[model samples]
Target: MRATIKDIAKRVGVSSSLVSLYLNNRPLAARIAESTKRKIDAAVKELNYAPSATARALRKGKSKTLGLVVADLCSDYSSFFAQTLLDECSRYGYQLLIGITHYDPEEEKRVLANLIARQTDGIFYALRLFPADFLKSLNLQNYPILQLSSAAPEFQSMELAREEALKQCAGKLYEYGCRKVVVAHESWANILEKELEAYGIKIVGGRYATTSDDFPYLNDTPPDAVASDSSIYARLLRARCRELGIPMPYLCYSYSLPSDFIDDPRVIAVTVSDYKTRLSGIVSRMIRMLENPKEPVAHLKEPVRLMSLDELREYRCAQLKDPYYEPFRIRIKYEGN
Candidate 1:
């Protein structure tokens, strides 16, 4: 059995109340001599007794724990988001429980059910797609849930504005002379990728994008273009580029590329915002709303913030570019256009 203050007091032949005061670093009355405090400390060290959080939380009637759920753990962005949520929750003296559902709706439902069963104080779920009846059921339960990166059927969520962000990225790529770029992405993600295509992007791997037997990458034949569904498939396409010796430069739409892969000069990776930074922002806003707990959820619908690739690149270029000009004297031109 784990030792408690009672056990420590029994071992030290002192009152449990005195032991508690000594253990909590509170000043005991002058009647309790310093020598007696040393005995209690020695007993505690010998027994390796630790305070119980379960007891404390039960007494306080607050669990002080937060649950975080993510759709796919394999994605860099999802993994980073999980870590960030934990860090953000820590600032509020909250413990975090994490759940991974691997992008399956049934699995996601199961994971959420498990977290709820564990009695987490709140939940933050990142989903690929929201399920039907998700919001209605939650509204019935009156649960505190935050959604990220997935659309909930009737449940409102904050997610990266993928379409808007990618459109800006694609436009920047077009400006940078990447006309024949291919955006290899999941089939369901094609809708999001199409936002860029609508802005005159001729991506090679989008829907209606073709494959050819005449291509050097295909040793034998070609097949009709089908949407990709996994990062492995995306890597296969990159490998095909290697096999064909196609020197086309590309930027990944998602934070699926590993750090090692991003180091490749041919690839320009877009860094998603730090999960902890974004979550901290969200939690701060939520805390502010809690000050006026009576406010409707509609009043709390401040847009979730996301960083754009164009903004990231521009920041990076500004940092890399020299601000001071060399001492070169140029003659002034008098002609006005």
Candidate 2:
């Protein structure tokens, strides 16, 4: 039979309530005599007593479980963020329940409902392509919901510094001598076209839905470089380049490239957001909100930087050659218009 609180209490010559309070680390338990505390600890060790998490949660009215929903599990960015969030959750004495929506609205709704049904105390939502009003309509009731990347006035969020990251990426690309560049996403292309034009770089905008083989308007005129808002698009561009037997142009990706492509020399530059820092901040904020739900919603932003080809290569080399080398110290200038 498993050792229980009553077992420890009986061995320590104390009340079960006292044992419970001490085991839970309640404030009142601190006032107990050191000798008595030592006796309780010794008794617990002798009996190999373990507290029941489920009973404690039931009494406290908290599940101690956090639900995390990501836009796409297949993407390296999402996977890395999810792992970081998991580690953060474990540090705060919470278990993580993860759900992947693959960017589908119906799947997202289903996952959210399922997580709630499983009695998750809070949720961390990280959707890339969600509609602006989608989260507002959700009836989260008393549960705290924190968003990553997506934003709304009703919930706390950690938003990406996309425009700044883009400017940095453009600067790095220009430094690489990319005079004409094709931006894969229309939305970002629209925002960045004039910005790049001001830097004397011609810009060609393409839709996000374009495929590697069927990219429009590229047959006659291939740009000197291809830039994408996502790693997926970057991969597609690489595939297209490989299929045509043409040298892959100087490529710049706004998001971290997938691990397979990270070392590819053709990928001239990338914009890397500090996801670890952002996720840690969000986790800390969420824990505080759980402790006091009435706390005002926080809007946090993390810094992003562009990594040039030379810097990336140097980092990769350091990883292979020097065990003590720190890659974050390498610096590059941002000169976008």
Candidate 3:
């Protein structure tokens, strides 16, 4: 059985009230001699007692746990972000409890409510779609609520400048001499689409609403080169491209992508240093803000590029300049020795 103050008091022949006062560092009865304090300390050591977590929490309001919720756990990016956040929570002397909402409004509400009931000190929410009532229900007036990737207002956010991220991808794609570039994805913000179009790159992929037949961009057979929203889709596309005889295409990816995907002969991915070092830049900054709300915090944003098969062979060391866009290279690799 775990030792408690009562055990110590019983062994020392003193009231538990006196033991509590000494343990809490409260001023003892003025007449209580220092000898009494020494005796209590000796009894505590002999009893080998450790305070309960419930007792510690009752004393300090915080349980030293942070709750994190993500829209979906299936995405590669979400998995990467969760690991990063977990590591950051450990660094801050806090435990992390994660929940997946799968972008469901009802699920998010239920998960968050459970976390609150458990007294999580703070919350980190990463959702693709923000339900209308989510913010209304959250009593964040006193708590520090952080949005890891989204820019919702109810919570402070850690975001990469969306335009800048897209621009980096576009500029690099242009570098590899892609005469005919077809950019496709499930869906992206209208503002981002316009920016990609401005680069003279064709936005071939249909929007989330477009049916396969309407646009037929990439044609399910895959294009010469492709950049996807996630690495899983990228590899799926790569395999499909091989089956269709579409030459191994140069690809652009995010930091969330793994190295194994890039190492394939048919794929040469841009390696962003952020993936290896300080991958938790977002979570780390969020935790720092929680530690010091008034210290003038800033978002952590950096870029990393991956090169695919065609890029690796064509521009292994090729340096070129572009007048219209950033002087970048679409690094690539070759497939089928």
Candidate 4:
């Protein structure tokens, strides 16, 4: 059986209250007598006693766990974000719980409520669709909410400057001699279609945000290149083209990590909106809010750049020592490395 604080108290001939005061309560540690603290410590070591995390969290009203509610994890870009966020959470000794909604409103609501019930310290919301006073609507007003969007009255947010990103997509595709593009997401496709029309590139077709197996557009003559907000869509398109014995077009998608797809010759480029910086930046704000409940609402915006295959290859070869991307040694060309 696992030893508990009561066992330690019994071993030391002291009250479990005093043992808990020294073990879980930090501010009150000073209140414990030096002799009592030493007795508790020795008893803990001798009995191998451990405090229950759930009990302590309930007492303190903090689980030290943050929730990331995202649309889908199948996408490479979203997966990277989750991985980076997990790393960030671990740095501060906090746990991360991800809830995948798959763009379903009912599923989104259920997952959110479940996260809150688990006593998540805060929630980092990445969905574009917002319901005003959503927390209040669910009777979860006291919970803190953060968003990947612009300034909002109720919650803190970190926005992405997507106008320039969309423009870069069209301009790069146009430069690549692409005249028509099929996008992955619907709402985003609507905005991107308008932007592409500005560059004389037409958006031929689009699909739902989460998942769509039927991409008849690729089965046909195929557009110049398939542009996607998520790399998963590009991957799906590639699979469909292969199954139908059709050639895949020059593909463009969003993914900052270049090393993951450098070998794909058909890929035209990937957009990098400084994903690493945005995640770490927002994580900092999340930490502040978790530590200080009264922290004011904060808002921010970031940029995006479309990096062509050549630029990505250059970035890979140079491989500078970066805090975000760890630098490593590569072999000389003579060894067939």
Scored by lDDT, the top model is 4
Task: Give the per-residue lDDT digits (tens) of candidate 1, residues 1-337.
Answer: 8999999999999899998877766655545788997898799899999988867775576577877887566654455556656767788877888887876778887788788777776677655534546645544234566555554433335655444545555556665655455444443345535665666655454343233222332333322222232334445556665777754345443432122122234344353433334567666654543344454443122232223445444443332342211111111112110
What are the lDDT figures for the candidates, one per model?
0.54, 0.72, 0.58, 0.74
- Whole-model alpha-carbon lDDT for candidate 3: 0.58
The CA root-mean-square deviation of candidate 3, after full C-alpha superposition on the true structure, stands at 8.1
Summed backbone clashes in each candidate are: 0, 0, 23, 0
**Model 3 agreement with the true structure over 206-295: per-residue lDDT tens digits:** 433222223244456444445554555555656665666766667654433332244455443443334423446655665666677665
Better of 3 and 4 by lDDT: 4
Worst ten-residue run, lDDT, model 4?
A: 327-336
Candidate 1 deviation (Cα RMSD): 10.6
Give TM per candidate: 0.59, 0.69, 0.68, 0.76
Best by TM-score: 4
lDDT by residue (tens digit), candidate 4, 9-96: 8888888887777887668779888998888889888887777776777678888889999989875457768988998999988889
How does candidate 2 score on lDDT? 0.72
Candidate 1 segments whose C-alpha is farther than 4 A from its true place: 4-49, 71-76, 129-141, 153-156, 169-236, 247-276, 285-294, 298-337
Which ten residues in a row are the worst by lDDT in model 2?
328-337
Q: How accurate is candidate 4 locally (lDDT)?
A: 0.74
Query: Which of 1 and 3 is ahead in TM-score?
Result: 3
